[model samples]
Target: MHQQSAGQLPAEVLAAFQDEQQQLDAAGIPAGVATVGSVMPDGDLLDAHGEPTTLTAARNGRPAVVVFYRGAWCPYCNIALRAYQEQLQPALATRGVALVAISPQTPDGSLTMQQTKELTFTVLSDAGNQIARRLGILTAPTEPVRQAQAALGLDLTTVNADHTPALPMPAVALVDTAGVLRWIDVHPNYATRTEPAAVLAALTTLD
Candidate 1:
């Protein structure tokens, strides 16, 4: 993705992203973040139609793979989600595991992503980063990156439901039928993602 973007995006924009990646790598995952065996927190979320929902409702008594992304405006996020829709959803469905994608973006953004990606899995709006905060996966673009985003005509304050630049670090959590988190992977850098194959392998370790 970086290789392709290098040919298309401005040099300053690329530099800003690279700088953020370096900073994130240096900081690493924050302390006290939720870990395996933790009970996943339930929180209010919005469906594609702006209707109220929750993680529990989305799971519907089935084990679930919960994905937290930055927003629909992120190309990296769109790529990962589209891949999950194509590669992960079908395999997970066979195992009776629900696949859900959540972001701090508005319901409108969620709807657009779902339709544009033709994603059959549940896409939700995590207003105010409720679940992400509890899971300790939340982060925000740096000032330099935010400026770069504005240059590209993207204003996260308006794109996100929380009206802030805050976003959840791209992360995935595997929760069991009883709502207990079995495995999790958090990426401090927004450019990277957890592969479906890794998640499938993690599932094998569960009961």
Candidate 2:
């Protein structure tokens, strides 16, 4: 899932990318999110409509598949999201499970994403990365990456709800009906995502 944009990068630009990946690798996975049986943390976020929503309310005795993505500007995120909507969402629906996607983007960005992708499930704006911070999956972009983003006209400050230059590692959590986390997958590489088939198999185990 390497970025198509990366194919045309010059030598210096590729060096910068390598440097950024090194920084991210050094940061590693957060200890808090490493456990499997932990309870999913509750947090307040805004839906695409700007209405306040909570994780607990969404769970409500039903299993849930919570996905954390970078944002709408990311092509990889878009591909993964569409895959979830077309494949995983339908399977989850049959089992009475809810599928939700969260990002640091503002409500407007979330709305744009929902409309652009024609996603029927919930898309929430996790302003200030409150949920990611709580889950210990929060990460800030390296300076080189930030420079690259700015050069590419991707001003995350304008798109993000809090104007913070941070993002969560792409992740998925499968929560049981009781709200306990049954499965978790966090990808350090933004280009990678949890496969819909893998998620479906995990959900099957919760039965």
Candidate 3:
């Protein structure tokens, strides 16, 4: 079942996200997310409130530290998201950076995620995996992984309601004020994520 707010996050789902959180080891800047995207893609995702928002509009006049997650259904993605909520935003803002999160879930699911994680930044909804594929980070889950997720009680049936069943590979990108890509970070495994400390350092380097 799909939820419209985070408060409705089933205990099992919350626990799953948290467990995925524990698997992270503060990945360094050069490890996984080092592959730079050739060009930044233009796309829009609805905010948690179900309002349409363009990526360009969200990055207005400031650099943006963007993180793309699968959806509320994924445990590992949420763990990475929680890390951003707790550490990345403040550090990035001090440097005139905006924090934006993208997901292929609907607006209702996005809201559920925000409430579930107490996220402080923008959570944009990309109902179709359109934007995700554009950045070259989206991928379909393996059959085994899908089966495991289903057995674990995750309901992906509705998360990817738009068509393609795709998710971002726990990726992060630092975009400059001019909306150009300064750096890109992505992990092949869903269980790992970018370290906030490393991201802070990378943001400074972009200066």
Best by TM-score: 1
- TM-score winner between candidates 1 and 2: 1
For model 3, residues 99-147, the per-residue Cα lDDT tens digits are 9988888777754635556877887887776666766676666554455
TM-score for every candidate vs. truth? 0.96, 0.89, 0.77
lDDT of each: 0.89, 0.81, 0.69
Backbone clash pairs for candidate 3 read 5-112, 6-112, 6-116, 33-185, 33-186
Better of 1 and 3 by lDDT: 1
Q: Which tens-of-lDDT digit does each residue in 1-207 have in candidate 1? A: 988989989999989989999999999988968988889987989988899999999999999999999887888888898889888999999999999999999888765535555889898999999999999988889999999999999999999898999899999999999999999999998889999899888888566
Give one digit per residue, the lDDT tens place, for model 2 in 17-88: 777776666766677774678878767888877899887776667889999998988878888998998998
Candidate 2 accuracy as lDDT: 0.81
In model 3, where is the ten-residue run with the lowest total lDDT? 25-34
